[model samples]
Target: MLAALWAAEGPLGAAAVQSALGGRLARTTVTTILTRLHDKGAVSRSRVGRGFAYSPLQDSAGLTARRMRNELDKQHDRGTALARFVSQLTREDEELLRNLLGGAGDGVRGGPQPGVGDGPRP
Candidate 1:
């Protein structure tokens, strides 16, 4: 649904979205889904006659990042959850994550150090 809106040249009405989806979903379902997406801030919408036309507010990467952030926020112990997440990452992924957080290269303090040791982390 979001993909359809994102690929559209402009905001699309629910019927258009439904058609873009190859008509696999009913029009009412498309409208309901769009309404839910609008409620969740995943899409922006404006009135089009009696209904609304919607467009994706986030690109694919932005959507994925938002979902990751949302999932992180749901944890009771964020520090532990983050640590566990980091611990499971591959070295290349760890480096990418570190660089993305405003650092470059290796041996950086507070960066994820994958497969460093069997000993406890600093």
Candidate 2:
């Protein structure tokens, strides 16, 4: 449902969401999901005539940050949680991330080397 709402590019009505879901979901189910998402602070809603329109409370980036923070807070060890995250990255992702943090060609000054690249300096 969130994905449907996301693809709509803005607030969506219940019928639009149902149509986006291929009509597999009942309106009540979608409404329940929307209500739950709203309670989770993941969606915002407003009354539009007889029904409500729903939209993401935050963009993708904001949602990701909030979810990441929530996951980290749930862990007993912050360091372990971070290490597990780092371990899950593919080598290419690791390299690109390294470059971003290291400020290699990103225009920022030196921070920390990614310890992965020897590419020609930009």
Best by lDDT: 1
lDDT of 2 by residue, 1-122 (tens): 87887788779988899999999989999888888998999998999999999998776767887899999999999999999897887775567667776775668743335555445333
For model 1, state the Cα shift of residue 16 in Å.
Answer: 0.4
- What lDDT score belongs to each candidate, Candidate 1 first? 0.85, 0.82
lDDT of 2: 0.82
- What TM-score do all the candidates reach, one by one? 0.80, 0.74
Model 2 root mean square deviation, Cα atoms: 6.5
Clashing pairs in model 1? none
Model 1 Cα shift for residue 22 (angstroms):
0.2
In the range 1-122, model 1's lDDT, one tens digit per residue, is 99999899999999999999999999999999999999999999999999999989988878987998999999999999999999987766765666656654444534345544334334
Off by over 4 Å in 2: 103-122
Every model's Cα RMSD, please?
7.2, 6.5
Lowest-scoring 10 consecutive residues by lDDT in candidate 1? Answer: 109-118
